[model samples]
Target: MYENSTELAENKLLLLHIIKSVTIPISNTQLTDIVLENSFVNYFTLQQYITELINTDFLKYVEVNKKKSLQLTQKGENVLMLFKDRISPSKLNQIDEYIHTKIESLKKEFSITADYLPANKDSFIVNLKAIENDTLLLDLKVNVVSKKQAVDLCTKWKHNSADIYNKILNALINE
Candidate 1:
C-alpha cells in the first residue's frame, strides 16, 4: 500500500515535470496523449491527478490563441523543484528521450492548421494558417460556394501550406 501511494505521488510529479518541460501551454488532450503515450499512467488516474492539481492551484486553465490550454502554476513549479528528486535519474532521462521524439511532431501539428466555418446559406469560409512560434506566416480566408469545396481547400491547405505559400509569394514578387 505504501508502494502504491509512492507510485501515485511519482506519477503526479511526473505530470508536473512534463508540463514544465514542455515550455509552452498545452491542451488537456495533448497532455493526456503525452502521458498515455509514454505509459506513465492510466487515463482515469491521470484525470484524477489533474483535478487535484487544479484544485490545489498547481495547475490552471488558460486561453492561448483563443483555445484552452493547461499551464503549471507558480506553486506547482516550487513543488516540483522541491520534490523532483523523488523521480529517478534514469526515469528522468527516459522522459527527456520520449519528449524529444514527440516534440517535433507536436510542434508541426500546431504550426500548420486549417479549418472551415459557415459563412452563408450556401457558402463556407476556409480559414488556413501557417504559424510558427506565434507568428503568422500565412493567414488566408477563402469563400467557397459549397461545404465540400471548403473542406477540400482546408485539407489541401493543411497538407500543402508551405508549397502554396511559396508559389503565391513567387507569383506576386515575380509578376
Candidate 2:
C-alpha cells in the first residue's frame, strides 16, 4: 500500500471535496459557493487551486448556455476514487485501457510513435518521437493526453516553441 504525506493527503482530500460539491459545467459562482459552504479554505485559495486543477487536466471547462463551466475529467474521477478507498486493480486496469486507447488514437493522428509504459506501480511514462525531429517526453503521473495532439504540438511548436513546451513539461513534471 502506498502512503501519502500528510500535506499531500490533505490536498487530495480537499480536491475531492471540491470535485464532489460542484456540478458538471459548474460556474465560478457555484464553485465559490461550494468553497464558502464546505471548507475553511479561503476564496482566493479555492480559485487558485481550481485554476491549477484545470491546468493539470483534473478539471475541464464545458460550454453550457454560452458560459464556460467546470467538469471533472477521468483523472479527477480516479483521484476521487482513491480518496474514497474504492480504487481496485480492476478499476486501475480499466483506466489504463482507456488511457492507452486514447494515446493510440493520438499517435495515429499526429504521425508520432509513442510508448506508454508503466514507470512504477503508481505512474506511467509516455515517450513520444516525432519522426526524427524531436522527442517529446511526457511523464504523466496521474493524467493522460492524446499522443497525436502531443506530436502535433511538437510539430507546430518545433521552432521557438520551447518556452511553452517547457512550461507544460514543467507542470507535468512538478505534478
Candidate 3:
C-alpha cells in the first residue's frame, strides 16, 4: 500500500480521468507521454500510481491489436465520477487540450505494428501492418527461414512502413 497523500490521490485520479476521457484503451507509453509532457508527475511516480490503480481494480490492462494497453475499469469510471473534482481545473483542462491535440497521431503511431512468430522448426512468420482509424491500410505476412531475417523485416517495416506502403501501392497501381 502507498501513502494516501493528497498529491498522490489527485495524480491517480487525473490518470483515471484521462483514460476515461479517451474512451478507448491506450498504450502505457502514450499515457506516460501525455502525463509527463504536461509535468503532471514524474515517471517513477506515474508508474507507481498506475500500479496502484491496477492493484485496486481502478484500471486494468487489455490487449488491443496484440499490444498491451491500459484501460479504465467500471470501478475506475465510478471513482472518477465521484471524486474527479480533486483534480485542479487547470490541470484537467491541460490534459484535455493535450489529448485532443495528439490523440489522432498517437493512434496512428500505434496502429503501425510488426511482430514475428515461429512457424515451425526452421521458419518464422512476420506480420506487418499499417492501420488508420481502425482501417487496415496494409497487412503483410512474410515467411522467412531464419529468425534474424524475420526480425530484420519487422524492424525495417516499423522504421519505414510508410515508405514501404507507398512503394507497394505504386508498384501495384503503375504499369
Candidate 4:
C-alpha cells in the first residue's frame, strides 16, 4: 500500500500506464507479473493500487470464464489525456464541460443525409444535413480521397466548436 498523500496519484499513473501500454485486457495475475518483473513494487501493494484505481472510476473490472480483467473507462482515458497534456485541474474541468456541451449540441443539430458517393474516379463523398430546431436544413459534404483514408476522422476533432466538425466526420465515416 502507498502512503495516503501520494497513493491516489501514484495508482492513477500506474493504471494509465498499464492501460496505454497493453492492447489486450489485463488479468490481475498478469498485472502482478508485469509489476514484479519490471518494477520494485510487490504483489500486495500492487493489488491495493488496483483496488484504489477501480474505486476511483479509473479502471473497470470484467469477469470472463472466472478470470478477472481490467480496462480503462472513458473517464480514465480523459485522465490519461489530461496527464499527457499537463493540464491543470481547473483547465481540465473547463475542457470537459466544453466538450460535453459541443457533443450534445451537435447531436441535436445534425443528421446523416447521404453517404459513399464517388468523390473522384476512385473516392467517396459523405453528406450531412443540419436541422435547426427540427425545421431549417443546411447541407454539408465531405470527400474521402482513398479507401484507407475513410477511417473515422471524428475521433481527432477537438476545439471549442469541434462538435459540428465531429458530427460531420462521424457521418462521413459511418456512411
lDDT of each: 0.85, 0.52, 0.88, 0.56
lDDT of 2 by residue, 1-175 (tens): 2244554445544555454543334566655654475443577767776888888887788874345667788887777766744333453444345434444332333333334555555545554433312243432222235555444544454433335446776887896
lDDT score of residue 148 within candidate 1? 90
Error of 2 at 120 (Å): 63
Clashing pairs in 3: none
Top-lDDT candidate index? 3
Per-residue lDDT of 100-146 in model 3, one digit per residue for the tens? 88876777668889999999999999999998777889988989999
Q: Which lDDT value does model 3 have at 77?
A: 91
What's each prediction's TM-score? 0.89, 0.40, 0.80, 0.42
Poorly placed runs, candidate 4 (over 4 Å):
1-8, 64-66, 84-175
Off by over 4 Å in 3: 1-4, 118-124, 144-152
Error of 3 at 146 (Å): 6.2
Inter-residue clash pairs, candidate 2: 106-148
Ranking by TM-score: 1, 3, 4, 2
For 58-168, candidate 1 gives per-residue lDDT tens digits of 999998766688899999999999999998787788888888888877776667778888998988988888878888888888899998998898888777778998998
Q: Give the lowest summed-lDDT range of ten residues in model 3.
A: 1-10
Better model by lDDT, 1 or 2? 1
Worst 10 residues of 4 by lDDT: 153-162
Quantify how close model 1 is to the true structure by its C-alpha RMSD in Å: 2.0
Residue-level error in angstroms, candidate 1, position 152:
2.2
- Give candidate 3's TM-score: 0.80
